[model samples]
Target: MSVNAQPCPGPQPDALVRVDEGAIWRADGKPFDPLQVAHTRHALSAHPLLQLPRLRRLALSLAGTSHVKYALPNRKAGSAFHTFSESEAKMSIASTFDHIEEAGNWVALYFLEDEPEYGALLRDTLDGMKAQIEPRDPGMHGYSLFMFIASPPTVTPFHIDRENNFNVQVMGRKHLRVWQAHDRVAVPDAAIEDYFVHDTLRSLHYHEELDARALDFDIGPGEGVYIPSTAGHYVTTEEGAWALPGGRVSVSLAMTYFTTQTARRARVHLLNAFLRDRFAAAPMPPGKSGLVDHLKQPLAKILIESRMRLYGQAAPRGMSGH
Candidate 1:
């Protein structure tokens, strides 16, 4: 079967996003919503565990499990997508937010593990949302909930994520700018290869002109955006928009789904990456042949596993950031 390419018109929607006949349409008049977008953004801040005091304590307590990133807004003009400058002041995780806020900088804490206090709530929220959207088989999909706390006026930078994400804006407001996943002009093919195979940085090279092709949304408290896997996007907080009376904070949850399709795509990319990076062979486009994917997957797995084993043997005993 031969596939013909056609030029499609831009989106023209009144709502940021609209669902009709089980299809979600974007502002640009594109039928782009595949992950089933549904969000109740308002109730996020009201969650008992997300309050500043509680979250601060949680950040401090889960010291080892969490990763803190300091945003350097001035570095945006540079080639690097995100540059993190170490905090000059020695502050604890609990005090990091305050320090960042005071310095007119922003710090983001990523909580990957599900804590006992809020794990159930996160699970329930995701479960409820999943019920309203697509019918996903539990066995075929994996779930993870990441809660982020960022200071005001910080830019998260342009990047593509591996998993389908439900970006729940619980507190504060943000400008979410998303570009089409398969748009080669926005996200380069090599970047996609590096992302899947090497687990390299997901940051994309931002271009001012590409903004014209993007779908921009100003999401406030009680709103959510469905970000499909490999869709390049950047998020920046609105200054003091979501701040409470005392201080500034933007709280959000990134609920991710790793489906069977995700795995297959990863494998396909990994195989292509292996061929291109190792043998200097031109990479083939995905979804062309099932037999090719089936053959490439096991070879990719073996190569990856062998690399891991070799690296494990060569590394020093105590170093452990895998």
Candidate 2:
């Protein structure tokens, strides 16, 4: 999709945040509480991604043009729903990635790595996170950052992400229902394999029975929620509630980190998939085999690098992004 690449019309300050084991703190060195977020929406509006000038330009950049995905409103009335045909959904524009919406329940996912300012911002932000996250793994790991902007009352279908995500809410309010990362019932092994290895869509199926076990909460501006890798969750943007005058415009930043532990686990999944699919072997859980884990990690790393090289050669020049 696209946005008006106009100059920023507001201030350009970055958030000063620090993360603890279970909570996030702001500049004052205190837990950043969301109890009063409704009153602070406008005051907490300094996110660089939301700055008009930068946002518009970034939205039109290659990242925005190539990796973008859009969905027309799901007009279904019930709470529990499933995939519907395009005819059952609202009339959508062409599948091309060169469109943008100004109103209605619109949504956009901007590939942040394509924007230079965002690339630098992500590096600096991850640098700040080193003290908090580095203890998990001494070796450096690659990361990705994406920005999401949605209009009011939009419901992102339930899904599981492949990497550890720190979701920062830049504007408006959102209610997120998340399940534990290791909950096999909520997330099946096949689903994980499809995402990490097969490059399928990140979304997962939803079951009404799983709702009772979910930990649901509301988040607002200047606040964020940590979503563990492979955790199942869904997002619902509030409808003009605690948002600006027009339809609620919720802007969020998603930081995804691939630590060593993540890499090892991904290797395990890849190995298990090979054994199961090729050799007809029994399923294997991650972190279960020291020998296999040891051998597969470097192998996985090599395979990943080779694939990247092949993809790089085939991809159009200058299309690479984090």
Candidate 3:
């Protein structure tokens, strides 16, 4: 299908996400909370645009672009994450896609909103969730859609992200384990601050012991889960759960956005990092002290803006380092 082709024939308003009654609720049985983990269902798994051929075309279009990343598959769940160099993959992207099932590769297409058709689909999906998201986490921005296509027996390294994510499985089945967003034991405050400051994941390490505290989900096509910002998580696609007949290639998409609360938290973390690194001050972690957090927010913003002006470095999406 062409990039502009609609999933179905005829003119109809697209509603990519489907949240049935009780589809979104916290464990405490409170009203819908965006910051908490919630299982959801979506129509994108059946969307024509996400089919392998169309995705291969998208990958070709994104070739040599920063938005596309290729990695060698990690068989061990605890292995560190790294990108594949040009020398490491001596094949064209199309060829890689052709052999993806047995190539032991993982490909990611980021910022799908920048593309024409995917952008429209992403917008519709997010718009469908506005009523549920806005009331809980207002001012959502920096919308991003990341598509991951990986071979079976591969693992996405355990790590934390800055934006709240709605991850949907498009094909195959994968085991997902997620920890709480505020679980400092899984991810330390210092590591989070370092991520915002340096854009690195070197400090975040995974240990098998963390499994005891994880909420695990084994999901297939049309199934999904909501993961709060900074939630430590990892995914593994098993060898036998391929949805298609030929190969065990797993496809998934992560739709992420930043809210007002996330923006504030980013600034606070940036400020804390500065204090710890430059001033030898051990500032309280974000959300730890209300008054102190409020006091640090503006100062952090000023610091970030000044740095941007002086260094020509744009702040992370939503102006929050995530």
Candidate 4:
């Protein structure tokens, strides 16, 4: 991983490109039939429970939604929260979108995909345009062998995902500036296993890399970008200009898949957790240290399955958002 070797430098995209592009939805290229893309999206998003159908809408809602979903008890160690209020000072803003704010300004809303404004747009677009989305940018993500699940437009800043995601831009666009899982980028697992002692793995950022190339894609509405598990990246929305209707309320989706890459990342983290738990409960003896480390891989699978069971919506609430 030559990530930390020399700071790749040019002009970063975020600073240069701000306002939304003109003729945003009216993109020229046709990698996939826009109509097809919309049909697929409509079929998948027909589920009423899905908060956000169009990726862009979902991301915005995540940003704008004031109501906090209950957090799993086993969620991140720091469980600080704020009481929902229209008149309250910006309390969670600093923590909620802290990762994204490192790059630019942010605002979140709580609108479901079924909402009239967003859902109607999504349904109309899907029904009209025969759009096809490029699943994952294979150039960046040849490591995994799996199909993507969803694509969402998110102002992401230094975070990991539950599964491997190759985010594709359908109508509007957002950019992805990725960091490798090596020393140059802030490695969460190392910090978690050693200093932090947090079992649930989360992302950390080392904004040391300033190269424009490091953060690729000065993309517009109708573009696609790829990402792998443990591959760190940041996102920011570029609103449309003054005349051309709405800003780049990017229409994107999370093309999720259970890939080999995700499995590897998961396995490694699970192994680390198992080792940490074992050591914390009872320190290993000199002769048993080798045996304990060797058993970590198989033991890791057991640990991952147990944790997944804790997160289903049907399951009882384990952690509170407040």
Model 4: runs farther than 4 Å from truth?
A: 1-155, 181-184, 191-203, 210-213, 238-248, 276-295, 304-322
Q: Model 1 misses residue 93 by how many Å?
A: 2.3
By summed lDDT, which 10 consecutive residues of candidate 3 come out lowest? 1-10
Model 1 is weakest, by summed lDDT over 10 consecutive residues, at 1-10
**TM-score between candidate 2 and the true structure:** 0.70
Candidate order (lDDT): 3, 1, 2, 4
Candidate 2, residues 1-322: lDDT per residue as tens digits? 1111212122347642222222232323433221111111122247545654555555555432444545657532223323333334432323221333334444454457556667666666666556555564434345677776666667877777666677776666667777777777887777777667775644356778888777775666656666767787787776655344322567777766666566667666765666667888766667567776777666555555666697753311111222
In candidate 2 the C-alpha lDDT for residue 321 amounts to 23
Off by over 4 Å in 3: 1-31, 85-88, 242-247, 320-322
Clashing pairs in 2: 6-53, 7-53, 8-53
TM-scores for all predictions? 0.73, 0.70, 0.86, 0.43
lDDT of each residue in 230-275, candidate 3, tens digit only: 8888888877665445338888899888888888888888988999
Better of 1 and 3 by TM-score: 3
What's the lDDT for candidate 4? Answer: 0.35
Better of 1 and 3 by lDDT: 3
lDDT of each structure? Answer: 0.58, 0.56, 0.75, 0.35
**lDDT, candidate 4, 1-322, per-residue tens:** 1111111121222332222122112122334321121111112222222222333334434443443221111111122221242225343433433343232233333223335544443334333332232232121121111111111222444454433443544333344555443423345455433322243333343444443325455543334444444455555454332122323234345544343333433454545655657775333321235466445545655555566576532211111110
